[model samples]
Target: MNALTLASASVKSRPLHATLCVLAAGAGIALLCAIFLLSGAVERSFIRNAQGIDVVVGAKGSPLQLVLSTVYAADVPNGNIEADQAKRIEHDPRVAKAIPLALGDNHNGYRIVGTTPDYLSLYDASFAQGKVFEKPFDAVAGALTHLKTGDSFLGAHGLAADSDDIHHYHAYTITGVLKPTGTVLDRLILTQVESVQQLHAHPDLGDPDAAEDLKISHEVTALLLKMKSPLSIMSMPRQLNKTSNMLAANPGYEMARFSRSMGFGKEVLTALGAGFVALSALMLLSALASSLAARRYDLGVLRVLGASPFTLSCTVIAEGMMLSLAGAVFGILAGHGMAYLVAVNIDSLQGLVLPQSFLHFGALDGALLGMGAVTGLVAGLVPAVSAARTDIAGILARGRA
Candidate 1:
């Protein structure tokens, strides 16, 4: 019979051992694949959303926090800056464009962002249904929010969906719905700056003076700025942080630092995956080596039946290869399957939505598959060689020992 047929029979005979090897290898590959896919998606999302914005200015606090809250909408803001102060920065000659963000309330779990129409242009957003908010209390829902035009909802006082502090004073009407841009915009509810101001202006509903005072002294959570020149990037943030009460953060720099901080966890996961793979390889080697004793008599019979030593060796090698290849294939599939699960459920895990492209298999996945195949070949080599140099005469004389 052929080497492949012999190998197939051998693997089937030791189903438990073969299955264990596949599971071990699959566990390792799953960790590595999930890390690669998740990290890549997060990096892409950060870069895409941070584009067009040069500096994020918020009340003095962590630069990273400012970037995370204003640019990614992933964190709570440090504090609020005066509207007059933000406007002063906006009119500066160094500033190309400045968009003020007033964040506080939410409808269900989605944040209601108060900003000008310029915010839509920053993301190159388009209408999936109607138009942008024109009057105070008019709103634009995101594609993922599932809120249709003409629907109205009361804003919760806090960022949490379950906040009991609801602003029942005014209800926001959805004037438009934004097409999916695969950015933070997809998860937000957009409205004019006055809408958020009105929602929060809890000015002792009995006092007109309190209401007027709030309108005149409005505060915004953060300012998203675009610099007039590349030099402004270095100058503006430094000048603002040192001279003003605001924290100025460069999105690119903060994100790079965030990535570096995440690298340690990724490295730890990679080490664990490598360890599992090594353990599987060693298991494969031990299994093959131990099985040789039982197979020696068979090898002797094959030798006497006109099979050359080279043919006998190939049969042993084929068994090792089949087991290894099966493990590799199983590992790759498990890895990607884990990644897909993580991607679909990312909202609950991290409060962020990853794009569908996160599940794509690329050249890196192919490289990983190749690495698995190579690992199998290496693990099986020594066992194959030992089988090749079997003492045929001794095995036949001793019979099936």
Candidate 2:
């Protein structure tokens, strides 16, 4: 038989052991691939949420929290910046646009954001149904929002899926639903800033200056700032922190800081994954070496039947490659399937949407698959050498004995 046929028969002879070797390698690859997909998705989510904003202006607090809340809608707002402060920033020569956000209250777990229609452009979002909110109590829903256009519901006091304190008296009607952008906006409820202000307004509620200009009485959770020039990054945030009551946070800088803190743990996990891969490679080597020992007599017979020593070596190597191929393919599928399952479950329970980012194979994935082949090559090398150098006379004599 040819080398490939011989290799196939040899592997088939020990199907259970071959499968075990593949599974060991596959398990390591699955862990590594899943981690990569999750990390990549999270990083992309952060970047997408921060797109087009040069700085975030909010109350003095954790800059990361402010960005996470205002940008990603994943946390509570630190505090509010006055309406006049947001307006002043809007008028700054260096500022191109300042999209204000007023948050608090949720419709079945989705955050209700009070912002102008300009907010849609920040994400390059388009209308999937109906139109933008034009008046108080009118809402433009996110793609994932439970409410459809023309539907109405009273929002709860806090951003909880089920909160006890409901705004039972007045109802907000959904005016539009945004096309899914896969950003924070995908799950948020958008309305005019007035709608948010009205929700907080009551005869008994306290305010520092309740009688102030009704417009000035409004307060926003944050300002999504755009600059006229890239150079403004240096001056804008510094000026805001020094002169204004609001704190200015650079989302890019904050994300980088977050990445640094997360990087060490990421490295540790990666090293652990590499270790597993190495261990599996060793297992494959050991299994193949033992198989080669058992098959010495059979391979010697093939040598007598006109098969070259090179053919025997190649046959053993082919067996190793077949194992690696099976492992790599299975591992890739398992990793993505795990990601898909997590995404669906997370959306159903917590509403934190994690898309199947692993489905898109990139250089990282290619390298991961390549690593399997390299492992096979390393594992197969010693066995192939031994097969090439096998003592045909000795094996045959021992077999006859």
For each candidate, give its TM-score against the true structure: 0.88, 0.92
lDDT tens string, model 2, 1-401?
Answer: 67778888888888899899899888888878877777777777778778899899999988999988898888888888888878888899999889999887788889988899999998888998899888998899888776788998987766788886676546899888887777778889998888878766641235433343233227888999999998897689988889877899999999899889988988898788788888989998999999898888888988999889999999989898779867877777777777667766676312334464556677767887898888888899999999999999988887843
lDDT tens readout by residue for model 1, 136-200? 99999988888999999988765787986667678999999998787888889999888888766
Give the Å error, residue 205, model 1.
2.8
The TM-score leader among the candidates is 2
lDDT of 1: 0.81
Instruction: In angstroms, give how far residue 114 of model 1 lies from its true place.
Output: 1.1
The list of candidate 1 runs beyond 4 A from truth reads 124-128, 179-182, 202-217, 301-314, 346-355
